[model samples]
Target: MTVTASDAHSAVQTLTQSSDTLFLLLGAIMVFLMHAGFAFLEVGTVRNKNQVNALVKILADFGVSAVAYFFIGYWVAYDVTFFADANTLSQGNGYELVKFFFLVTFAAAIPAIVSGGIAERARFYPIMLATFLTVALIYPLFEGMIWNGNFGLQAWFEAKYGAGFHDFAGSVVVHGVGGWIALIAVLFLGMRNGRVKAGKHTNFAPSNIPFLALGAWILSVGWFGFNVMSAQAVNGISGLVAMNSLMAMVGGILAALVAGKNDPGFIHNGPLAGLVAVCAGSDLMHPLGALFTGLVAGAMFVFVFTYLQNKTQIDDVLGVWPLHGLCGAWGGIAAGIFGSEALWGLGGVSLTVQVMGTLLGIVVAVAGAFIVYGALRLTIGLRLSEEEEYRGADLTVHRISSTSND
Candidate 1:
């Protein structure tokens, strides 16, 4: 055994590629599990009569999203397609495939977010169509502009503001877009039956606190992969991202506890708000800055959720707008503020650019949702019939329930 230098170099290259592939694959798996978190979160929040529908909606949407993203969405966003043969696709240890798997999970989150807002009163098939269209077209448009730098948007931001829009892990691209779109769907569908009767807001409390807590826990755990793995390669991983995520999670929890006054639902969703807010700046912020960002997000969720339900009567179950939409917007803006050298941050961002990008994201998301959902409302329809809603989606659509009548 003679060991050659060439052989050793070849071995190192293989190891590096393998490591990157495995890292992304694991990240994909972790994010994939977040769908279960979405399902359980919705299941626990909606009435038991709609539990099965919640579970079914998340899974079905994920499946449809995969198809849409694989066949069309990925191309629109990145000009990359998976149309080649398997052998050709297997190059680079199939890293591109795993990358698609990972990012598609993010894309699918649009429908998952909407499912919560329109729970208990949506038609399954119509929503599936919406999911397909959203993933294939609507979501990818923003994703491409933000993530892929499509149309020179990022370059334009940098030229105007001395820094490009910086969303490290898709605070605006994924969560914000999903939340705002969900808001449109909720508005278009109107409040659930009996949610507000005779101008009196009725309480539609969560059905299962334990399940809600479990869902939150899963999302919190999986978010590390969601954030850290955005690096998408082993060589780029950062301990800072992980630490920031932890600090933000705790900040959210404590703030929610204080703002929500120990309410179980708010307590559970608090960490999620924190995590959502931290995703954009996790790589660039100090742990303390991350903590502040999380605290703001938690308080925002509790207060805004209450306001929307009581005053606006939006009937957004699980408050996805506050938890994802508003907090995600905050994350995008806070990234530029907290990521500055003056704040002991990494110092490559501009606050002005952040605000512009965030506002643009809001406009794109809200407008896209309005167009798609409005068309659905006008044509194929969006909401269930009043009688069917009273019967519950599980019974009327799925013909099953969380509990056995027998």
Candidate 2:
């Protein structure tokens, strides 16, 4: 029996809508749990005095992402056209679900970045404002360019070349963006109380390694969701992605153990480093390649942290730089290295092009964060007063009770 053209069109449309809804829902859930990961990680870094504030801020980040991404960031970061095609868009997509997961993770990342910069001393309101700008406005633009398949900068790059800036997952898009913003905030905020001396520094303390360790573990778990689900194909390639993600994590752990010749910052950031390292190439790389990438990531984290810590007096409460920035660059470069003709052919895309594309993303992400944050610093005054520093952001900004139970 021959079907009518109108009936066929209707059936196809119905199927397309159904599948898109499923994928959107899946993406949303994966992105949502990332908030739990951020909360644990931030709370762990702080002294007990600030745990309540950290938890509250973390929860607020989720709310911020949910509303901002839905109302604004989603459209800014994602919805656009590729070329001169009027009425063009991504395949069978809807805004609500795309951002449900992607922007949630994006939003959480900003607060995660801020956690290190203002950890022991920041006022909640300023940090919250920065989070909004980073996710709601600044982040959306970069994200829009990267993922907005229609008329984004990334879409233009893909059109010029063969494939888009193949971030398989977001390295520069999420991690690097947050890392730069955090770096800017730290520059304006300066070090915490007594972290520096006359050009030198006094004693530095985590004050709670257990909390840090717990956050690291949660991050490791949540990161699996982050990586595996990024296999947008769900069934076919997800297993390979999961294998690669674990391999990089293992490689990072091994490298960290070795790096802990005497100091154990490697242990703290081991899994975190691996997750960031493989982000660029997770879908493309084999397990062995991911392991090697992870090893490089672990070493990179150690090297960047040691050099930065000694060189600059910046007080990153969570050391987000080594985890996100150094390793994010590694993720992009790894895409160039591990991207293979044997596995997933670039269909003739040059390694140089891939690497350039990745670097281009870095340029955009860093520049965007720097400009917005610099302006925000000048206009609103990024950091709190000296009196507020010792008091903690919880007490100074929100003026809430500080009981451990609360």
Candidate 3:
């Protein structure tokens, strides 16, 4: 049989498409595993009585987030929907569907971040409702603005500044937004019962250090897929992103070790803080720049977490605000700095634009959180009763403990 040029071209296209599809699918699967990291992280940090609730909340939030994002959030962000027939949806080897899967994992992370902050005190159903609202509506608004270029926000930034805001992997879009929103949810829920006594913070050490370490390890491993695969295509992948992510992780570990006074929790979270910061610039930075960014983020998490716990009444369990929110913001700004060619980076970022973009993310997060959590607080209540709290959410909500003996 003779093959025509058109047929040959078509065959090559099909092969490329199939390869890209498989690449994205693997990336999506790796990110999907991060949810287990979130679950275990929360489980280990909260008291033993609340461990089961922590595990349940992460999984439930992911389920709700998938539904919300599929039906609503994807449309809001990319102006795309999956209402078509299966054949139509599966045209590109289901690449688009896997893309949605990858992104929905990010969307689900907002509620998981909030889960840690409000754990042990929040009611289950209300939190689920909040997750639905946030993933379906609030998160996608900013996500569209930055990622999809939906509202001309990126054009405006480029017009005013030399370059548009450049968050290659969602330092602001995901981590920053999640962290700030978690802060507000934590505030609305208030401190857990007996967390403070007469204006003095009480010590609530982690329930399981091994579990905490395991969670951190899982997140760290999966983060390679999270940052590297943001390219979304086989042709677009870069080793630079992988390298920067590694340097930043080590920087965070070492900095946190020194700054956190060798605390195990701080040590574990240090790498996360670094990873969160490097996400914005992983593709643009020199490895050394990423290292410095990680160092700053690691130390910042320890210091800010300590300050918030000691100096303020904000009872943010697991310090999501410090780890994700503030470090995420730093990552955004650091991209502008370390991503500049002057600093041995790839360049094409404007520091001014990054600052503005970072602040905008924070504003959106704070306002959206207030609207969602505040409404929940006023209408159905956001917290468990004091009696329920003392009994722990595992018993009050799930009717099971982490361990049982017959």
Candidate 4:
């Protein structure tokens, strides 16, 4: 018949819990749509004969990551206490809901990146297995540290150096993971066939530039949710975070337009580059600083991808390394440079911490990716059989599956 004051407070907390759940769901939807953007971009970059396979592979990766990670992968990463000062809903099984929502889309992205590199090749099963491993094990380690602090790299840095690294969203965690994985995938799979056959069109042009344009635009749009909403606890920096994201995009696009010789292709990549570049600083950078950071990142991808393709043998499929990996690194560094000491009383973050974060991220991401892919190549093998690679994955994987129907 009587209610205690504790009951009143608990009821209010319960209501707040519902509100957080709704917001988290919204962010999840926005992030999931980014996967669609990746799909369209992959389709635009790959050969037409492989179109069905591209969409199918992406769908499969999303489905696989969702189910596998939810069941066990989330527990492994968040359970270990990757960060010390960072938030971890609880140990063992407490953080499942939050970790699940954040990681599903990230896991989905790895396959999309792989789709570009191993396009027109790679048997369905091998790619699926590889995708599951990367998302299930590789990615969770990175995410676990950043969010849960169980491993406590950030804590160690803060404890030893009195400064800490920050990733406003996940320039390193999400994009860097994908980029590094993409690099390894291509290395193992080798270049696409006819990519360098003498006298052939080695420089495979995008089949649908318009699609690239639209997808790039969508990626840029989706990034707002990726960054602004990432301040999950709401320490009062969301507005500035959103505005900085917008500014960076604008700056990135303009710089790309100026430097890309009026190529819309350059422009599309520019916004993407800008988004990648500003990710670390989305919560910290001043508007002008964000713009500059974006500009630099945009310019790098415009030239870097072209130069790499011309100079090296790595056909990154859709420039994932340059756009996400390289750009993401710059974004992280930009945060320290742009971050003021005043926001959230978090104080001015040091450039040393930012740069260290960037460097550490690059080494770990690239090496970790290479190791997983190499082991797979050595063990089960990462590439498809020569005949399967030539014939296309859709035909190889599906023709057999559909034989009963016909």
How does each model score on lDDT?
0.92, 0.69, 0.93, 0.74
TM-score of 2: 0.84
Q: Please identify which of the two predictions, 2 or 3, would achieve the higher TM-score against the true structure.
A: 3
Clashes of 4: 12
Give the C-alpha lDDT of model 1. 0.92
**Any runs in candidate 2 off by more than 4 Å, and if so which?**
1-27, 80-102, 150-162, 233-237, 262-265, 342-349, 400-406
Candidate 4 C-alpha error for residue 211, in Å: 2.6
Give all TM-scores, in the order shown. 0.98, 0.84, 0.98, 0.87
Best by lDDT: 3
| Selected candidate, larger lDDT, 3 vs 4 | 3
Question: Could you give candidate 1's per-residue lDDT for residues 219-283 as a string of tens digits?
Answer: 99999999999999999999999999999999999999999999999999999999999999999
Given candidate 1, what's the lDDT at residue 320? 96
Candidate 3 local lDDT, 146-227, one digit each (tens): 9989789999998888788899888999999999999999999888878788878886999999999999999999999999
Question: What would the per-residue lDDT of candidate 4 be over residues 1-406, giving only the tens digit for each residue?
Answer: 7999999988877666666655666677788888777777777666655666777888888998876677656776666323343445443223336546765776677667667667777767777887777777777777777766757888987887777778878887777667777877787777777777674437777767877777786777788878776875434338878888888898889888988888867788888888888877687777888888888988888888878677777877778888887888787777877785653323457678878877776676677778777877788876666787676665666653212332
Range of the 10 consecutive residues with the lowest summed lDDT in candidate 4: 397-406
